[model samples]
Target chain A: MSNEVVLKFHKVQKKFGDFTALKDVSFEVKKGEFFALLGPNGAGKTTLINCLCGLTDRTSGEIAVLGVDPEKDPVHTKLSLGIVEQEVNFDPFFTPMEILRLRRGLFGLPADDAYLEWILEKLSLTDKKDVRARQLSGGMKRRLMIAKALAHDPPILILDEPTAGVDVDLRNSLYDFLRELRTQKQKTIVLTTHYLEEAELLADRVAIQNLGETIICDTTKNLLGKKNRTLVIETCEDEEVRVEIDNNSLDLESIVANYPHVKNLRIHEPKLEEVFLEFTKNPKS
Target chain B: MNFKRYSTLAWKECYRFLKVWTQTLISPVIIAVMYFAVFGGALGSRITEINGIPYALFIVPGLVLLQSTTNAFMNPSSSLIIMKYSGTLSDLLLPPLSALEKTLGYMTGGIVRGLLVSTLIFAVAAVFTGKIVPHDWGVFLLMLFLANGIFTLLGTILGIWAKTFDHISGFSTFVITPMGFLGAIFYSLEMLPPLAQKLSLFNPFFYLADGLRYGFLGIAEVDVKYSLIASGVIFLLLFAANFWAFRTGWRLKL
Candidate 1:
């Protein structure tokens, strides 16, 4: 609320033995921003999340969450953070409600009957609260993960693959909930997901990473707006569509001269995936 | 966070185990009683007694120590490992809980489980045999702590390093079980050859078993008082080991 950054990593580097998990990765999540870190598997997206959350130590550089360093004050700093890990960690022996209560108790929070009831209601898990975690469907288990993360009402939520492998309808529902979180609840959301469309739909900003480095980062509009700059057109003509090689490429006369049906030419626009792939094609560079 | 809340967390973990009494609570008890019935009834008749007490009585503390240590270690280590496996660890790690809070929560859970198994076995022993009195409170508590602490440390390491289900079970079978038997759980170190007797000193579990037996029977093959110092040293060492395991993140981060 105070125009302060909720989380920041300045040139953060994390290495394990000879392998670098994250290198020169730096970014800032402003207060109340719904930011997304988009990357393929093992692209150091989760590593960045762990380092910020203080689950893993950064090899070098600095990190701050809510003005407190995760290393120096892991306890205080984590107070306002919530994490939804990619894998579900529900105990087979525990019911979803008990798991929630146990998680809340770990943070030393008092038992709030009303609040607990509200959360159960919000997640539509009231009926199955008494059911063992193992019995819950996969989707239900994932929801329990979110419920656990939000148990303490942390101001920031770190969602790792929040909707991976989920059905489209459920994914859309999650999106609606997350959008509400950003707008109405004012929770700062940092999402790392493989689905680019989800990022395009919900993220206020998006950062693409490859080989432990951020290849490109900008507002979602700016990144996707690149698609508008270029257009891809399809025509029935099977001619090897080599238009021409000239500096004045957009000159209408010159463009049409090489291919008489250039008037029917389709301009190909770059998609977010194309731009992303292009950036990471030569990651070292 | 208040200790009361931490206590609640620990109780929650305890309740988790208790809820499924068949696996966590009942299985260990059945295993111990089987060991006692088979090892003690069949073989104990021939041995009669070890040192001064009845043979069954002599091994009771060792079995108690074994169940206690295993539970103490498994409850937290397994919980964490399973969390890491299922991705639940982030729930606590991402919360306001500090490393200390986490350590306390997990260990308390383990300790509760240990005590439950210990008490259950103790009750069974009381009903089955009338020899259940401690020689020294200090040594008994010390043995209780070290047996729990050492395995807790070992479990922490195993939890961190395990990548699959097989890895954890492998540690229990190859490392922990062998160590338990070697710790003189069912026999006296005096019966071993001089070389083996010398080697037995290396197993910390031996001293815990001996110390705990000494507490109950008013005498043990090893010096009851000395076990206190030994157990304390073991506790300190394992504490540091687990602290390092947690600090380094070991195989926890992927």
Candidate 2:
């Protein structure tokens, strides 16, 4: 990812009547970055995305997709961004080819049948292109939504739990597909998913939101590196305890003094899941 | 401004109804045939002719207006609420198309459906009455265009305003059907009492039906020019209202 910021949110706040959904959320995503927005349910992750897409108006603050304010020029904002919502929302009556044809027209692109066919092929939907969306299996429907989002080839793609009901094999393949898009096409990707492992495995930068606030935003390596290593000690009595290591320093004498009957010792590195829980579980920390 | 996007949405709406041809097109024609059988066949015997034209022939224009306008209204109304509830509205909303473009696109579906149904009903009317043709083709086309444009735009407004299927059905059952029945379709103003004749002046559907009848027979109870002006005004008003609803995203964007 380069220093060029392709998407940005500045203190974005959204309220539905008396309840605030997004409170003081601010972040920037650089071009070609795989950014994961990690948050608990109702933590304003989707709400923030809605604001960015101009689907819902924000109560306060600003959002810019590729240097253009979405509220000011929603047409331009939508033209530059492709969003896959959480639900399967393609028209059930239309076939995959018909849906893509309209999507291409909506983006003001020429009716390039060859390109659309290629997208269907890449997504493994070419076989099912002529079938109505309602007849497709759940996995195929999900894949069709992905194909629709990629139809226009927008520079930035935002996926909201794209692999929610996908099978394990399909999920792994989707991950590979996303990786190819990011590496080969250099498309900036923003993903929000319940599966922390997907985010950890794919994202270069992570932003954790809790209770309508962004608690932490940093690179995956930095967030995980900031966490201290653990020293797991096992006693002869089969008791086990953990000690936090600071700055990679381990005082063997102090550890031996503390655990006089130490039978085993091992060091453990924190996973992104652990780091994510630490921030969300205790936002103040 | 973007004709491609607008035409795409228009065709999408058309394809949606066409996909369910049994429900959208064929069913409405069947219902109109039933109306022609019951009203024109049974009732025309009692009232032989009204104003030199056969009773069945006189009711032809009204049935055409009814089927045409009703289908036009239902096309956008039901399609939109269904899309909204099913969450497929995002397909139209997330794109770069402008509100005006969306409005025109949906309106195209309604107008096309309206005209198609009207053509079929006219054919059925011809079979019963023999070779129906417009006495004033210009006025016939004008009345059809105006009625379709008006109701289609009204449907667009109600589609965005409606929150549920009930909202759409409620308006159709309560407001549109009543107005259509009382709109001088089945009877002329002269057949009613003097007070009722005066009251019919306020009904827009009366103007539409009367205008259509004038186009078919070159005769009308009221001044054909008045019907023309009223229908034109209603179309413009609804078009402006639809444009405003789309621009503000009134009930749609939230």
Candidate 3:
């Protein structure tokens, strides 16, 4: 991936009336990077997304999408970004094909039936292409949102809780599709999701935001590596115990010698969820 | 400034009403026909002439203006309110469209709906009165365009301001409907006493109806030149207001 920044938030602050939604938040997403922004409810994720998309104004600080400030050049900035919002906001009366055609026209892009057909097929929405959006199921609606976002073939795609309420099968397929977008298509993706496991599986780098501020930002491997290694041991007495050990001190020979009655031993690396919970649950950390 | 984007937005707005022609187009046409049947048929002979023109002929222009203006106001207001409520407005907002493009796109829908309703009214009037010709076709078309443009802008403002269905209905009920009736659609302002005629001057709709009437019948209570100027000023003001609203993202952006 190129080191060039695709998105940058420099000490951004967003205030609604007297209440601040984001407080001195700053981060940068590199080109062709699968970046995950994890936060609990009301962690300013949506507010941040809104500000990035020009749907909401920032109280202070600067944001640039592909080096273009959205505030200064919203139309041009929006042309490079595609957002799959948390809600299904499509026109109810329009069919999937009709909506895509309309979106393509809105972006001033020429019609390419092959691309449209490929997007529909990838999202498993081929059969529902002619059906009104409102008639589609919840999962289908979510996929339709993705399809609409991809319609313009924007360079950067931001998915705000794309898999919320989505079935496992569809979610897995979407994950695969997103991976392909990052790997084969070299598209930069910024995702905000409540599903930590999904983020752990997909995100190359993850940022945890809490109480409207980003507390931690690092690569997924580095973040997970911060926590100590865990060892789960099973003994002949049919007893199981989990012990936390320093990563460097985790030696299988030493562990077996220490627990002679051990029947089986397994080393466990801390999952992303553990690190996320640790960072968010303790704000001062 | 992209023609393709502007045209697409405009086409979508037009397509929305066209797709629901039964409610948007046919219903208004039916209501207009009923008005002519009741007002023009039942009372035509008794109230023979209004301002030197036959009562039936006089009301044709007024009814046409009334339907067109109401439609022009309702189209954008309801479209915006519905999109706002259904959370579908983000579709338009997320696009690379400029505020001016969005404003013109929405206004196009209202303009098209207004013209469609006006044409239907004229068609129905032709069948009944057998005379659909105008004194000055240029003035007639100009008045029609200006009148629709004014209401379409008003609807856009109300659509942005309104938060609920009741708010939109209330605007139509308390504001637009009363203004239409008081604008002298059924009778001439000259028929009223001196004081009432003076009070009628305060009504903006009066200018629209009077200007439209003068276009068709070649006679009006107000000076056509002054009415044209006033209509032009009002159109510019409404356009400016809508432009400002979109630019500031009033009630549209968070």
**TM-score of every model versus the real structure:** 0.82, 0.97, 0.97
The lDDT of each candidate is 0.76, 0.89, 0.90
Native-referenced Cα lDDT, model 1? 0.76
DockQ ranking from best to worst?
3, 2, 1
Candidate 3 lDDT over A90-178, as tens digits, reads 89878999999999999888888799999999999999999888899999999999999999999999999999999999999999999
Model 3 misplaced stretches (Cα beyond 4 Å) = A252-260
DockQ of 3: 0.81
Model 1: docking quality category? medium
**Residue B194 of candidate 2: its Cα lDDT?**
97
Residues A67-113 of candidate 1: C-alpha lDDT, one tens digit per residue? 78888886777778888888767767788888888778777787775
Count of clashes in candidate 3: 0
Of the candidates numbered 1 and 2, which has the greater TM-score value? Answer: 2
Which candidate model has the greater DockQ, 1 or 3? 3
Error of 1 at A201 (Å): 2.7
Model 1 chain B: ten consecutive residues of lowest lDDT: B92-101
Q: After aligning candidate 3 to the native by TM-score, how far in Å is the CA of A151 from where it should be?
A: 1.6
The TM-score obtained for chain B by all candidates, in the order given, is: 0.91, 0.98, 0.98
